[model samples]
Target chain A: MSTGLIFAGTGAILFAMGVAGVMLLAHLLRRILAFNLMGSGAFLILIGLAQRAGLVDPVPQAMVLTGIVVSVAATALALALTRRLHKLTGAYTLPATRDD
Target chain B: MTEFFDPLAWLILLPLFWASGAFLLGPTRGARLAIVGVAAQLWLAIDLAVKVGDGGTAIRHAVGGWGAPLGIDLIADGLAAAMLLLTHMVALPLLLYARGYFAADASVARYFWPLSGFLLAGLNALFLAADLFNLYVTLEIVGLAAVGLVAAGGNATQIAAGLRYLFATLIGSGMYLLGVALIYGAYGTVSIATLTPLINASAASAVWIAAALMLLGLMLKTALFPFHYWLPPAHGGAPAPVSALLSALVVKASFYLILRLWLGPFAPLTGTIAWLPALLGSAAILWGSWQAIRAVRLKMLVAYSTIAQLGYLFLIFPLLGPDGLALQAGGMQVVAHGLAKAAMFAAAGAMIHVTGRDAVADVAGVASRMPVSLFAFALAGVTLMGLPPSGGFLAKWLLIDAALTQGQWWLVAVIIAGGLLAAIYVFRVLRQAFLVPAQGERRHLSHRAPPLLEWTAFTLAAASVLLGLRGVDLLRLLAVGSGP
Candidate 1:
């Protein structure tokens, strides 16, 4: 029970940190890392949830695996877009305003 | 053989299949495949609507022949069918317009076919999704396709916009996945129908947290109020048909998820955070419309107008408290706004094609140069402004009727005020179009858009108007299923 509590708590904290990072950070790379952090946090929570069930639940495990794959794809695409933006604009951060 | 005939699987699968083909085969052959695939999708959607409307029962297909709960299930009732009708109807014309708009040598053309097809499949899957986790997967598909389409412009600003959009959507979906995990951990199942009875008042905190997380995610994707910062830049920067799709369908996908959750698995928590959506929605309407009125770019104005239009959808949450009528009113509003917005974007795109400018003032002489495109824009504006003989008018009437019956006079005021605001932004362009510049030389300099492009936009605009008089069919279709 304590193990379950620790893992779930840690997962929630990591997820919250990701959300904050994405919201507060301006740099594009930091935001991408934050997104990945959030995904990992969510996956940790999924794992912790299965642990709490007291038996290894295959369903949440399957879901976590699928989630990892999706996370990879999203991160890859985001990085590609970021690269394109940096190449075109010579900046790794989004402009503070929409005006060009 | 029986499984092969299922439209639900085909609806979600065929476009994905064709998208792969479009990519592997290159654009020349790929564009043709997309045209054929979208046409087939339209046919399939119409067939499903006709069959389901007549049968008065939803059609369900379990993938891999697995039943609900054990494996993924796709269900399409009246709501799903109507949205499908909206999506495919808008897509068909946009496809035709795109055929003319893009030069053969443009690199973006190659990507458009595959990305659009992928987006379509994802949307259909989202509408049909009965499983929460499945909805997440489809959401990712739709989100990625949308970001890809936005980046098709391949410029600095457009890429920045796409990157920002990707971040916003990913965070939203990530929160949603966390919520799904919580719900599954608590309920032991991820299917909405299965969890409907399982989720009760006993676990109100868990349900509340989960619902809040999911709703937050969806609202972010849908660009409600402050979250709408990512929307205009992304939508405005995309090429025209892509803009129409993103504005018309992609945003609606997330909103549809919100509706599904509210009415389905999260039904137990109906009273939880209900008023918040409506409050935020009211703010979105006023702020968005005001911004639209002040916007200089034509596409930006239209994008802001979307934010305003989305506000009315949230009004249902508050009004649904007293009367079930508000739910239908909201659905009707969805159909109305979706059609009108798509038409508006398409016509604006055609105008930009001729004038080679995206600013409302810069395109002043386009009115005379391309009367059909301008007329299409004007007709679509009627619907956006909620004028008579337009579907927007009918939708607002329903919503007002519901609010009045419930003694929600404040909502009535908000509705009217929103309409007036919509009229202001819409007419801001029409007023520009009406300006007769002394120099007629500019008209000669502008290129002529093909009739196909003008007529495609016109048909969508005309349909939104016609939908006003003939909304009974759609309303009847919406009435299916034991609903809120």
Candidate 2:
């Protein structure tokens, strides 16, 4: 397989693992990390698929940079929210979905 | 590209400019600037609509003089213009209401103006975006801004709700980006106009996966049925103005993206999967309304009702035809729900402000105590119930007409049944409001709501009802630049 396909395949595995972590994990901080992993996986796939033929494409590279910025903002916000929740309620996981 | 005056770019940049200006100006002075800014946006939106309607073509703009396939493009058609107008119309009154609502609480207002500014800017850019990657960025802007607004309450419940909303929105946008990546890999282009013909020419597996990923992500964001768990808490727990903005506009933004993609590049692949959204929509109508009826809190009821109402927007997917009747019906539903839901949430906010409580049962004496707000709530309920002289009535009428024409009797049944269920939940609140409180149950009013707050809610509710009479013009506008 081409280098691009190989990297995309790995990215797909990472994405699956990230999704599983997000869904099955109870810890909010871990969930945030998993979310980042999911984002990174998608970014990898974006760049990998574009370079499947070994020709460096600037478009997906540019998109990956933009994606990373958005990911950072999202992560920071998530961390802030998690910290606030912990400060206020002293809990790491969300309350039961049916608690309301 | 710079030669001609472009209202599209201004519609976006104006909000971002005012948002920053508001941030630096502080809460009190910033609010006035926000009002002025939104008023200008309303005018620009109206002008764009008139221009698109009169010209009968979509207006397209390439950023920095770089054409598509290499740079971003923005396009505004009748459908987009209508949404822009709707956003501003709802926003103008809500801003007025928010100013009065948050007058005493500077903390919430401090972030509300700038965040809402970012939200409106993101919405405008999303509506005008002609490329998939650009849409993803706009989605993130809207998602983050909305999450910040929800968390602005800073209470434990609100913060937790915000965190849940944050995760949900992040997942939604992440999936959407993956879909965009796949589309890019498959077609080597992200522009909608360029990809439409190309996608129609091929039925590759990658295209199908991209469509599925994008649809699912948008569904989660729109809070359609099964994925709706995160919505009620985030929308219900936030301050009233935040809830109004979220329920009325934010969800509709993602729904619009779904419709845009379905009608554009994914048109050919949509036939086989058309029934999926409609099926889920039927479930949402039944399930969400039932939950709304059971909700103990007033805001939660309105929030749950939002889920039910959003289901109607998806019903048109299955009924789409060459005549565009389903499209018109969906547009009408979106506008009607947008106005009525905003009014309902605003009225509920007024009631909560006066009563200083959030429970449905606590509104026992609201009818006599705050007649204007109670009347506003009832008037909005009229629209939700799909009663006469309301936009909801006209939208349902058109939807049923289209369904009957297509021989989809089941959809007709779901539509009618959904309206009936809506009436139950709406009346549940009204009945409580009109009830006479027992001797010991009477609660003193915590504070009198500002007349601005009550009147703004009333005006929006009245406008939603009045839309029934003038829907033809909107329908005509919806037809501009669309296929026959």
User: Which residue ranges in model 2 land beyond 4 Å of their true spot?
Assistant: A98-100, B1-5, B438-446
C-alpha-based local distance difference test score of model 2: 0.91
Instruction: Write candidate 1's Cα lDDT for B1-484 as tens digits.
Output: 9898899889988899989999988877887888899999999999999888888989888899888767788999998999998899889988887877775436888889899999999999999998999999999999999999999878887888888899899989998999998888787789888888788667757667888899999999999987998999999888888898898889988998898888877777777667788889899999999999999899999999999999989988867743457777877788888888888899998888877778878767667777898898888888888889888888888889988887878888888999899888887887788785524666567468889889989998998899989888888888777374
Worst 10 residues of 1 chain B by lDDT: B437-446
Pairs that collide, model 1: none
Clashing residue pairs in candidate 2 (N, C-alpha, C atoms within 3 angstroms) = none
Error of 1 at B283 (Å): 1.1
Candidate 1 wrongly placed segments (more than 4 Å): B321-323, B438-443, B482-484
lDDT of 1 at B50: 89
The Cα error of candidate 2 at residue B104, in Å, is 1.2
